[model samples]
Target: MNQNLPCTEPRPIPAAKKVTRRRSPISLIWIVPLVAVLIGIGLAVSAILQRGPEIELQFASGDGLDVHKTKLKYKEVAIGTVTAIALSEDHHSVKVSVQMDKRAAPLLAGDSRFWVVRPRVAAGGVSGLNTLLSGAYIALDPGKSRNVKRAFVGLESPPLVIGDMPGRQFVLGADDLGSLDVGAPVYYRHIPVGRVVGYVMRPDGKGVDVRIFVDEPYDHFVTTATRFWHASGIDLSVGADGMKLEMQSLLSVVAGGVAFGGGDASNGEAPVASRFTLFSDQTTALRQPDSIVQKYVLVFNESVRGLTVGAPVDFRGISAGEVSRIDIDFNRRASDVAMAVEISLYPERFARQQRNRPTALPTQQGLRQILDGMVAKGFRGQLRTGNLLTGQRYVALDFFPKAKAAPIGWNRPIPELPTQPGSLDSLQEKLVAVVDTLQGTLQRVDRLIAHVDQEVVPEVAPTLRDARQTLARANAVLSSDAPVQMELRDTLREVERAAASVRDLADTLEQQPQSVLTGKKASK
Candidate 1:
């Protein structure tokens, strides 16, 4: 085959056409890097969308706080975190920047409250114990308003009573602060039902205004007649009735507290913020105001040593009045001083005792007439010892049937009430009079003794001498060996012999009753 084809001159072999292929926009190897870039961009956008609101909180101090670790808790659940802390423009406080989660956005009301929760010691008690282990953090007590706010002023301490708590608030007007302070407990029937929230000086600066909170269920106990008093320290009162001790609790005794009661719960519940007077004690709070007071002056002619101002003026063992003042005056009829005691008589006391009471108490003029009639009927005033140990005395209004009649001095500036000597004074006067009579009797006894010694003794001496002489003679006659004795003995023997002869004759006559008008009875 090669010898025949060689004559063609070995034509050159045609070259193969060059092949051109279009490439894809991306290579398989480059697709891996593009996917990674897309994932990174998506992550960055997600982070931007998840960002939260930032708020500034001005605080007095940055105590127990870290830049980024501190958290804001609502009911122990973290809702936000502290991002930054720096000094305020005024340099007086620290400004804290907080980033709040979107979920907690609704809680940022205009009235929302913010405070630092640390281990706190207050009048209420030790709180924030959990913070000791978890470290200090910010706490939130949301407001009820719909308005929202961002920047807020942080409180140095937690509020004693949270606003959202189920309770009612009331204002109390007080004369002084005493031991009462924020967190002081409020008691009803010795049970803790509320707490003191705050206090401030009055605008007049004459007193203080205290705010208190009472929890639900117990708030219904407050009524128009509700009475409040400071149950502080030991409520100890020693009076004529003896000693009384009342305390709500041990904490009340130490830190002080407020107690309210003695009102009928059936009455209308006092509205929140109702004004009430804060009494110093329960007694004063519960005491009914005395109306229809009648003042009278009692002039006493006896010593009022034990009687003092403020002494009770009791009538029939019931207190009707009190001694308001005491004054000394020269007695017109006697050489000693007299006492003028002014008394404040509450006529309502007598009216309350009447089983069939009148619509109203007696008028002043009618009261005077009544008093005048009573005085005519022997009504009198006297001082009686109330306590022997304390020597305290009280005025006693009583009827004295035998007391001399004395009319009231109506013409004087102050009407005078007739008064008799005090019970103790009467006894003292009786002792004095008895002693005087005894002294006079003793003088008479002395006179009698002197008269007997001077007048009767001389005459009695002579008579005694004569009696002695007569007794001596009688003694001589009675002597056993005297001649008179011998004669008397002989006469006695003669009489005995005659007596024997008579007795023998009587016996013979009796034997012969018929022989000699009846001889003596026969010997048998």
Candidate 2:
């Protein structure tokens, strides 16, 4: 019984000896580690909150983009930074990762435009020159639309005009694209007011269409009758007015440019998207459109050698129109070849202008009536020399009162205008006749001269020899002092005295015709 109790008591005593461990306030050292862990978590959250969104931008080249170094700028203010650079999947472009500032997040829109800004020279002169010292950067242009976007494709070149510029866009149709270039200056009276933004070939393959932008105040000057011309390079023209040199500016001369002016501004501005013709030069652009052109066919009986498509068709001394076409046709009835000249005539050139009258002429039927009257008045077309040195010819329409009458038939495809021989041709014919007459006269004169040389010359020589021999015989007789010569001298003296008396009497009669009939009276 004592052993069992002792075992129980010892267990109870052993349990008491095991000290009770109490959890004391956590140690300050432990608190330090926990606070540190909490601080680390707070810092991580702050970092997450501050980091900006990453966006992908594709570019034609990575020329000026640099990871961590290149920046995206708007109005010269940094808005984002490039973080990475990589080749696109197709390897045709460069993929750039940009970290855009939170403030710039709204700018990442579908219509937003971006381009790398580096030192470059363009028709507008040196651009992005500031980038040379500060290194390259990406330029951003905000869009007007509200559509949001993340991925973007950058432009290879900067836009001609930046965001929402106040201007008007006009399309100019031209036969060819001359010296015009992107960013080329557009001048108004030598003042830079706009720029050439783009150009494209027409779908019909007929011509090129140039797109231009004119600034606000300048756009107002463009009217329905406005003219546009290529003003690039130095315009050197040598014409009847003498040498003329024209240029918009030195920059225009070097790069290329355009000019617009000459319009009926009194009618107000030109409607937007109005199609206008682009001329090669200012002279062509400034030509007046003051008349309606009527087509006519001229059947010429003479050569059309110097006549060209653009030859001037004149009425009297004034230009009425231009030559359109020239062709040869066979006259089946007459079995002869005839030359047909198609001409466009503007009746306004010769028609008397009434005071305050409209510039445009009447309709086709009215023109036909006028032409018919003119034909009855002996109106005829003839080719005439325009420039003697260049051998250029023009059609001259004139009235020939004495010419053979010929009627213009209304049944022809084109109204036929009668033609007469040109002045030059008539002059040539007269000259040929005169040359024939001169040749005949020259032949007769040559025959006369030959006759004189063969007959008259020989007779003259024999007569001269006989006279000389007679003179020699008289001289020999006088020098020898022969008795017969003395007797002849005495006889000559007596005859001379008698001749003197007759000469004195003739002188008296010559003084007065009546001296022979009446005795001369002496004056006191």
Compared with the true structure, all predictions reach lDDT values of 0.87, 0.85
TM-score of 2: 0.73
Top lDDT: which candidate number?
1
lDDT of 1 at 496: 100
TM-score of every prediction relative to native: 0.71, 0.73
lDDT of 1 at 524: 54
lDDT of 2 by residue, 371-473 (tens): 7888889899988887676577889899998778888867898878888889999999999999999999999999999999999999899899999999998
Candidate 1 — worst ten consecutive residues by lDDT sum?
Answer: 515-524
For model 1, the superposed segments whose C-alpha errors exceed 4 Å read 1-53, 145-148, 299-311, 324-340, 409-414, 427-524
Top-TM-score candidate index: 2
Candidate 1: Cα lDDT at 183: 91
Candidate 1 lDDT, tens digit per residue, 1-524? 67666465677999999999999988899888999999989987875566568889999999998988999999889989999999999999999999888778888988889999999887788999998999999999999888888999988889876767887889888899889988999999889999999899999999988899999989889898898899887898755434578888999977899999877867789998887888999987887779567788998877677777767899998888899999987766777777889999888888888899999877779977988999999999988888777677888999998889999888878788898888887788899999999999999999999999999998799999999999999999999989999999999999999999999888766666575764345555
Error of 2 at 428 (Å): 2.3
